[model samples]
Target: MEIDLAGYDGVIVSPGVPLNRHPIAAHARAAGVPVIGDIELFAQARSELPAHKVVGITGTNGKSTTTALIHHILKTAGVPTLMGGNIGLPILSRDPLPEGGVYVLELSSYQIDLTFSLDCDVAVLTNITPDHLDRYDGLEGYAASKARLFAMQSPDHVALVDFQAEADHAVLDMAPDGLGCLFLDDVPVEGQENWPALQGPHNRQNAACAIATCRILGLEDDAIEQGLRTYPGLPHRMERVAEKDGVLFVNDSKATNATATAPALAAYPLIHWILGGRPKTDDLDDCAPHFDHVVAGYTIGEAGPMFARILKDAGKTVTESGTLRQAVRDAAAAAKPGEVVMLSPACASFDQFTDYEARGEAFRAAVEAL
Candidate 1:
């Protein structure tokens, strides 16, 4: 790749690349070249493009499902929409949409960091949790990156944010008055028990955020409900892989953190959970609330032994399966007809596999083998 922005107006670096340490980024900055991201490019192209609205969704978790849900709802309501940016194809790679189409962009903190002026028509925050800590000062700093989605929005835009604690988050309390801001409570979440793809309490919050976005875009309640019911879930994010006899095999390899994996654990009882790769945290403390659901844990990868010890210490049964195939086999054998075999490792897959998708595929293969 070319290091310098020779004839380029700007440079958009990946979030994983720390700009502070990258020489090319520093050089670009010194050369007075704009250093932005996909979101910024999208913002620049908005005026020249067809008449359309933009919905930008960002948070620590649940952003992917929420983004897809909003797109699904809008499309179900007969509004032309495109889903991209951090989830599917790169935003800049897609052709211009027809007039009145909506572009639902799932922005990560990394992408948001590189974005400068993406004033989305609707900015949705699924809820901020402690994540990407090694990249930022702490959770507060990471949260601030997510808050930028709302910060860069226009005055007439809408903000749909979520709550974590009993009280409204002081972090989002300072949301700009110019743009309308609504929390999850403002929108009714009465009937989500029927959404097959969208399960768990975290998804309920995702659904609320999506519903609010659709409503702001002028969709009817019936249409939104239909969208939720008809939406096909994203792969590897709580995806139901297979069912043999009565036991369900769920591939949630996308749950690369405790927060992400916690919901998967809550979705089913008597689970033979397959967790552990390159562990994100020393302990799975965030998943403590759902531990009662796990009948046993099949630990694998670099964190296999570590997790085995942790589970044993907690008075839970665990086995060091050390690989996805073995973990799936053991978990399946251990699971009863009514139980679940879940591959929701609350850790990165780099230790054993190329990425989460590959890890998920391995789980799928193992499940299909049985």
Candidate 2:
């Protein structure tokens, strides 16, 4: 695509467009045109917009939940709020936030790589794990991509790095005068378990991060806890669907990897585990610690046979259900009272469904149909 760049000052591309490999991006660079993402554009326009605060959140997992939680907390605390970036609308596409408004953005690694000028008022890293290995040099390279969020922030801006990583600490130091970093222990959440919508240890950590972010944003104690109790969690991620005669059905289809699935596995006991799809790994070894809790393992989709072999080899009750409908049905049929029929496929849903949301909706529909 050849074009004159004199009329336009810059070009903004989506994060999915790999600038390193995409020819159009190179062409834009060749023309001496500034090429960046929506986030950068937002940053450039900030001076012209109303006075506001921005909270940028990123991680391998929990980005969606944490972003939503922060947005909810800010809203509950009576601060005008808008959400965008990775979870919702593009930042540039939206109008400037109102005075005293806060923009809570769920940024992905790809988005962060494309964004250069977004110095968030409050920047947060949920945690870093080996993910998108195909996109970066290795684990360290991926971690560095997350670190870029802090690097773009002003020294006076607050940084909340929840996950402990010595390497991440060093990289974030690149931020102007090092970041005003905040850790989990700095926040006080006395009875984190009391929040039902946010169950499990991971959510507790997420809660702590949100609590700290809200306090930094000037939220009072009552408002923070109110938001925590009222914050409706994101769909397709540890979503509780239904319960039938004491049997619970959970749809956690967003667990596209083992790390994402571990929390769901830990959240329940006596689970009629429903898992499979296009396999990211050959086995469910990451979930070994929770095997005793899985009353039976029902496999489905492209990875059904592979998961079945692994489960059988591990001396577990394994069934190659081969389809989500069958797996849910089988699990529902086998589950006794007080047991959980959980659909937490720790693999991509592309083999059967369009995406994780579609997969989760199917799981919910199947459970409701029972």
Q: Top model by lDDT, which number?
A: 1
Question: What lDDT tens digits, residue by residue, belong to model 2 across residues 1-370?
Answer: 5677765778878788876678877677778887778788777888898999999999877788999999988888788999998887777677777898998999998988877889899988888877888878898888888888888888789888864654454556567785688776567677766676787778987898899999898888888999998887788888879989889888889999776788988877788999999889877778887787888999999988888887788888988898899998999999999999988888999999999999999999899888
Pairs with steric clashes in candidate 1: none
- Candidate 1 lDDT, 162-218, residue by residue in tens: 756214335554456777778776788978778978888878888888988898999
- The superposed Cα distance between candidate 2 and the true structure at residue 202, in angstroms, equals 1.9
Score each candidate by Cα lDDT. 0.85, 0.84
RMSD of each: 2.9, 2.3
**TM-score of candidate 1 to 2 decimals:** 0.89
The alpha-carbon lDDT assigned to residue 274 of candidate 2 equals 93
Q: Number of backbone collisions per candidate, in order? A: 0, 0
